[model samples]
Target: MEAEIRFGDFVREVSLRQTHISFNELAAYPKLDNKIVPINRQNEKLKVSLKDIYRILGPYTTVRFVDQVKAVIPLAIYLMFFQIFILRQGIADAALICGGLLSVMVGLMLFMEGLKLGLMPFGETIGNTLPVKSPLVVVLGISFLLGVGVTFAEPAIGALKAAGQIVSVEKAPYLYAMLNEYSGALVLMVGAGVGLAAILGTLRFVYDWSLKPLIYLSLIPVLLLTGYVGIFDPELAKIIGVAWDCGAVTTGPVTVPLVLSLGIGVASVVGRGDSSLSGFG
Candidate 1:
C-alpha cells in the first residue's frame, strides 16, 4: 500500500512493495470488448470477369493439339515395328493384348478389396478373440486350426503344387501321391506351429518377458530338424525345405496383407503394442 499526506504546499509519500500480483486487483480493471465485424455470405462480386475467363482459357485449347502431335512419335514407332517390319497382322492379337491387360487390372482390384474387407479383419478378430477363449487347450487348439486353415488358402501353395508337379511326376513318378500329400501336411503343420508360436509370443509380451531366448530356442529345433532331414530321407528333405519355404511365400497377395495386418492388430492388443513383439516372426 502507498499513502501521501499534504500540508499547505509541502507533501510526503509512503509506499509498500509487493512480491505477487493479486487476481482481485486484476478483476477490478476494466476491459474493452469490441464486437466482431460480420462477413458477407453472398459471393455476388465476381473477381474474374467473363472477358478474362475467355483470355485465360485460350491457351488451353492449343495444348490438346500439342498433345496429339506428341503422341505421333509413339504411334510412328509402333507402325514401324509391328505394322511395317514384323508384319504380324490380325484383330486377334489386339483382342488378346487388351484382354490380358484388363484381366490383370481386374484381378488386382478384387485382390485388394477382398483383403481389406474380409481377410484382414477376419484374421484380426481371430487373433484377438482366441487369446480370451475359455480354456488354455481350446485357445491353443483353435490357434493351431486357424493357422492350418489360413495357410491352406494362401496363394503361395500354388507354387508348391507346381513344384510338386515338376519333381514328383518327372523325377520320381512312383512316390508322387505320397510326396505331394506329405509336403502339404508338413507345410500346414509348420504354419500352424508358427501361428501357435506367435500366440505364445503374445503371451510372453503380456508377461513382460524378453523375446531373444524364445527366438534362439526356435532356431535350435529348425537347425536340428533340417540336419536330420538331410541325413536320413533326402527326398523328404527337399519336400520339407520346399514346404517351409512355401509357408513363407504362400502368405502372398491376399493372404500376406490380411494375415500380417491381423497379426499386428491382435499382437498390438495382447502386448499393448510392446516394441519387442510388434513385428512378424
Candidate 2:
C-alpha cells in the first residue's frame, strides 16, 4: 500500500513536469452498442393461408408471363414475317414452330424469375457465409464443385453440344470429336478451369490483389497455346475458335454472376483499397 501510494504520487509529479495538452479518454466508436433490448421473435412472425398466397402472387405471375410474351413474340413475328414476305417461303411444321415458340417464352420467363428469386439470393447468402463459416480449403473446394456443377447445368453448354452437329466432320474431325466423342471430358476440363479461376479470384479479393498482372500472366500461356495450335497442329487447331468461344459461353448467364457474388462476400471481409470496389468484377 505504501509503494502504491508512492507510485501514484510520483506519476502525478511527472504529469506536473509535462506541458503538452492531451486527453486520455478512448475515441468514440459508432458501431458499439451499449443498450440491450429483448423481444419475442415468434410474436413477430405473420401467419397467412393458401388463399392469401394465391391472391398476393397471382397478378405478379401473370404480369411476368405477359412480359415474356411481349418481348419474345415481337421478334419472332418479325422473323416469320420477313421469311414469308421477303423470301416468299412457306412455314414448315407450323404446329411444331408454335410449340417451340411457346416453350421458349415459358422457359425464358421461368429462367429470369428463377435467377432473380433463387440463384442470386443463394449466391449472395453463400458468398457472405462461406468465408466466415468455412476454412479456405473448404471454400475453394466448394467453388470448384460449384463451377463444375453450373457448367453441366448451363443451358448454353447443352446447346453448344447439340449445335456440334452442324460442324463438318470432314473439315474439322478433331473439333467434331471434341464436341461429340470427347464432350464429357471437354466439359470436365472447362469446369475445372472455371473452378481454378474461382479459387484464384477468391484469393485475389481476400488479399487485395491486382487483376491486371494476373490477366497478363494468364494471357501469355493462352496466346502461346493458341498460336502453337494454329501453326503446328491442324486437326486440333480446327477447334481454336470453338475452344475460345466456349470459354466465353462457359462464363454464361449463371457462372459469372454467381462467382461475383461469392467474391463480393469475401471482399467485404478482408478486402482493402480497391479490392472491395472490384469484388464484383
Candidate 3:
C-alpha cells in the first residue's frame, strides 16, 4: 500500500508538470494564493485575486463609490426636505416621495457618468481633429460651434435667469420684465463670448503660444472696451461688469470640464509644432 501511494504521488506530479502553465497566465487567474502583492505609495499592501480582478473590470464592472454617495446624498436629502416640508409639494400620491428621490439620485449619477465618459471624450476628440489650414477661419468656426453648442445646455445661465427675477423683483417690481429680458440677453452674450473664446483658445493651442501674453492681449481689449463703455454711461459700466462676471458663472458644471479639456488637448497639439502656440496661450 505504501509503494502504491508513492507511485500515485509521482504520477500526479509528472502529470501536473506536463500541463505546463506560465507565470503571467497563472497571475491572470483569480486564486488568492497565486497572487503577487505589491506595496503602494501609501506603504500599504494590497490584495489581488482573480475574483477581485473580474469584479473591478469585467463585463458589467462597477466602481467602489463611497465618496460619490457621500457627496451627493446630503444634497439630495436637502432637496427632498425642501420639497416635502418647505415647499409643501408632493406627488399626486404618497408613494412618489421615494420614487422622486430615487429618480433624482439616479439621474444625477447618470449625468455625471455621462460627463466623464461622453463629454470629456468628445472634447478631446475635437481637439485632436482640428484642421491644419493656414487662414485660421476654419479652425475658429469649429471651436465657436463647439463652445456655443455646449454653452446652451449649461446650468449656470438658467440659474442666473431665475435668480435675476427674484432679486430684480424685490428691488423694483415694475422692472421685472425688463430684468428678464436683460438676463436673457446677458446669457446669449455670454454663450456667444464663450464660443469665441473657445475658438481663440483653439487657435492659440495650434500655435504653441504662451498663456501670459495672450491673457495680457485679451485684457487690453477688454479694458479698452470697459473704458469705452464707462465714458458713455456709468450705470452701463456697472451693468456690463456684472454681466461679464455672470458669464464666468454661466459656464457652470456642464461647460467647464468640456471646455478645459478641449483647451488642454488643443494646446498639446500646438505645442508639438514649431509655430506660435495653437490654442489658448
Off by over 4 Å in 1: 1-98, 128-137, 168-184, 227-237, 271-280
Relative to the true structure, candidate 3 reaches a TM of: 0.56
Best by TM-score: 2
Regions of candidate 3 where Cα sits further than 4 Å from its true position: 1-65, 73-105, 132-135, 169-178, 219-241, 271-281
The candidate that achieves the highest lDDT relative to the unseen native structure = 2
Stretches of candidate 2 exceeding 4 Å from the true structure: 1-56, 81-90, 166-168, 271-280
Per-candidate local distance difference test: 0.58, 0.76, 0.63
Candidate 2 least-lDDT 10 residues: 20-29
- The sequence of per-residue lDDT tens digits that candidate 3 reaches over residues 98-167 is 6766666566667777886799768766665665433468767877887777777887667666765554
What TM value does model 2 have?
0.69
Model 1: number of backbone collisions: 1
Per-residue C-alpha lDDT of model 1 across residues 1-281, encoded as one tens digit per residue: 33222353132112212134344533333343465544434434335556555455544333433444454546645764786457865444766766665565555555655775687768766666765665646655665566666666776666666666556456554346544757666566657765676566555645655678887888799888888987998666655655467556755675555546555655655666553236445
- lDDT string, candidate 2, 1-281, tens digits: 12123476465445432232222212222243356445333333344557556566655666667778999999989999999999999999999999999998888888888886688667767877888889988988887888788888887898888878888889888888889989899888988888888888777776667888889999899999999989998888888998897898887878876777667666666546553455534
